[model samples]
Target: MDEEQDPSGIAPLLMAIAQQDQQSFEQLYRLTSAKLFGICKRMLVQSSDAEDVLQEVYLTVWAKASQFDAQRGKPDTWLTTIARSKCIDRLRLGGVDRHTDLIDLDQLPEPEKIDPVEFASDKQRLDNCLSNLQNQHRTVIRTAFLDGCTYHDLAARTGVPLGTMKSWIRRGLMSLKACLEK
Candidate 1:
């Protein structure tokens, strides 16, 4: 179902699950398992491993259901986030080798096309703003935000001090904000 047509019943089910309700948890798995499984399969690239990760995802949900904050994000997004993180962890653990040859670009479905005019304008604006950043600032900001590296991770990977890394990101974001506001 399209997002607009999908029911909002998942929130209530999550709430019940938070309270240790088995029936509600079962209902939630029945409703979202297919979607979550698809995410796992796409990331892991193996059906058996995806099935294993999906089970781990639900076990995590069962344990951390109370941590779900509806005000922070929707139920589906929260679940998807959990599944994605679990998949990444599994990938990092050497469950899957990183090889570009394993993927066939031609076999992938085409991406939805965007309006050319809007895309050009947005890309130009973003490029202009990103260009305003100093070399180190730009690298730090892009690595942290785009690559999803934590501050400590960035510091360790680049051999820069943690405080220095944070300073670069903070200053870079401020500069980016001022540029984008133009």
Candidate 2:
């Protein structure tokens, strides 16, 4: 079984969290916060907004940890679902107008137009760099960053070990960063 699915892993931590153990809560946050933050950032697209929603997500987790049941689902999935739900809620409420006076729409500045040739050049450069990677690294990097699959998800889907998947992604990202910098 994957460590994520092992009873001694996140499940035990969550069970402790359910019992109001502060240390377990801290451990859970430490273990899962980065993934949760990534999810928030992807959905919200603003660092501050994502950070605010992440805080709300953890608060919800702390309040609702007792609601988590191992039989129903894995702890990671439960946490991911909560994060998604909170992000969606934030999006839903985001449409409400807080301004007392409405500004004239005609007074707004024109949106900047991106140069398609420049955009395509960047994309082609990235594609070239990706083509230079080992096939597994390229595939894993694309799936994780482009598709937003979590490490556990990628590991389970690819039948690879979690640590290996993490290493692949880390190295792949570093290579991508180096390539992009040039």
Candidate 3:
């Protein structure tokens, strides 16, 4: 927090604060608060809650900066990791699901009724069968079947025609079924 410290020196200043330097701590709070708050706001999506989490992350950073061993990663990653962990902790404690904006149950497309026991059975068999497929086909199937991509998103992402994507996924499913039965 030296008055002449360049913008990139915040991490070292943070390191200084770990040794209990109050002046550096104040300067870091003043310099990095707005950027950190913006990032937290984007992540948490609630101003007051984000502010609370921000405060908590800083307190954590102050208390835990000594835990920031540079060999593991850079300082930005260290600080951001603490911030992200704290926000997740806040969300967990607040009992708010991050996916609250997910499709309403009534509005969701009905998923295929795969028997969970059978589907979860013999994962190795499934992987081996999937490995037999070409990477492009395997990728499309994984995205559509396992990851639940829609026909449109799959088409867009894979740059395949909608019908072709559907066909690849359908054929991939049939192959998997035949392989699993064997």
Candidate 4:
């Protein structure tokens, strides 16, 4: 199995990292860096900026390893949150003009077509699972994940507390996972 999917392995690595173990830190980086880098690249347009932010993310992870609570969430989720926050921070600081970097849809190459039969089957399963979620959960999950709204932004827009927003999303995701696994 891929180590990236093994949360059990990561929990121990995080524990060792909390104690300032360099080898464990490197191992953790190897297991998760590609995923985190993709998150950085998605949020920040420039590859150089993404690389810089990714380094900063690892630094933050190293410093804040003790703050991680395995009982509260998965290691990848914690890592992803840190990476995403760092990217947002870089954007907020005006390192890049996000609006100026927008792609012209007309100039983009056409995407490859896929088999509609397979696509519709997977999409139908996802839609069915999403429909099983609570109304608030469904809305929050779609807005947060699909629309790329941050939890803080979602909370503010909906007039709910940040922790409550997070709980709703977490519960929604857990329900979706269980439903999809069937």
Candidate 5:
């Protein structure tokens, strides 16, 4: 079993958290916050939003830690699940108002048209950079960005764990950034 699934370690910490032990809560936060934050950051796409989601995750943990059952899953998995849910909730709430304010296209200034040759060159370069990524990375990045899928949607479509899906997108973005920079 992976360290995450090892109940002997995490179970005790969680039990302590359930009992409202501040030190144990601190220890739990110290152990799992980075991984949880990474999940939030990947799903939310804004560091400030991710930070808010992370805080909400901990608050939920504080209230619901007593309900966590070790037999059901690992502590890390439990924590990450909460983080993912919080991030998705925030995403949905934020997206609700996104289309409410409409700018009239007729009233707006005209966009500058790009030169076709330059556009083609940029597109080709981007395609080349994307092609450099691993198949999994490329697929996740494209599905998430190009196709406008959320992390939740991508995980459901791919049948992968939400955390794994987030990792794929995050690593894919980093690889793309490096390749594009070169």
Candidate 6:
């Protein structure tokens, strides 16, 4: 069990929130916001964007508190599911994959971002797992996926042949795929 929970999980907090209890919502945010923000920022890759999603996640939390089943999982786990689902929804809507690296971040029109749920564990298992990879492999994976950098970007940054960078990303992602599944 998460040590951070109130005596009865977040159930009491949820009821407070559902009843528009500002104080409980503040307490809940204090208790869980950091973990949730970490997940969203890692996936969304931008602080402002992650904050947008965080707001959405909280809105869902307030609206759907009754749906959370503590018997099925921890309160944190239910919160994370909502965060993750919301992130996936943004991805599905093509908001996440928008051409940022191509256009300068400042020049692009800001899109309305939903509560960002990123593909991350509620815990840091993903980081612990990723750390096991070689530094170069990690760089490739982060550049290709998280940073949304291009193969050209990788090649340019590392001074590797473009083809080589492509091959490395392909193989590296395959390794990541295997590791992620396990």
Compare the candidates by lDDT and give the number of the best one: 4
Per-residue lDDT over 1-182 for candidate 3, one digit per residue giving the tens place of the 0 to 100 score = 33232235666776799899999988878877876786577557778877888999899988987787655655655666777677666655765423223222233332234334423344456667877875666776654433334667667766668898788878878887888789
- Give the least accurate 10-residue stretch of model 1, judged by summed lDDT: 97-106
* Candidate 2, superposed: residue stretches over 4 Å from native: 1-4, 95-182
C-alpha lDDT score of every prediction, in listed order:
0.73, 0.72, 0.65, 0.75, 0.71, 0.66
TM values, all candidates: 0.56, 0.51, 0.50, 0.58, 0.53, 0.50
Q: Which residue pairs in model 3 clash with each other?
A: none
State in Å the error of residue 35, model 3. Answer: 2.3
Q: What tens digits encode model 2's per-residue C-alpha lDDT throughout 66-133? A: 89888887777788888878776776677522112222323433323334443346557777787777
RMSD of each: 8.4, 16.5, 15.7, 8.7, 14.5, 9.2
Clashing pairs in 2: none
The better-scoring model by lDDT among 5 and 6 is 5
Q: What is the lDDT for 145 in model 1?
A: 40
Instruction: Give me the displacement of residue 133 in model 2, in angstroms.
Output: 26
Candidate 1 global Cα RMSD: 8.4
Q: Give the distance in Å from residue 53's predicted Cα in candidate 6 to where it truly belongs.
A: 0.7
lDDT per residue (tens digit) for residues 1-182 in model 4 = 23433433787888899999999999999988997898787777678988999999999989999998877866767888999888878876875634233223234332234335434565677778887888778777765552256777678767778899899999999999999999
Model 2 TM-score is 0.51
Candidate 4 stretches with Cα past 4 Å from truth are 1-8, 97-182
* Candidate 4 Cα deviation (angstroms), residue 8: 6.4
lDDT of model 4 at residue 87? 81
Model 5: lDDT to the true structure: 0.71
Better of 1 and 6 by TM-score: 1
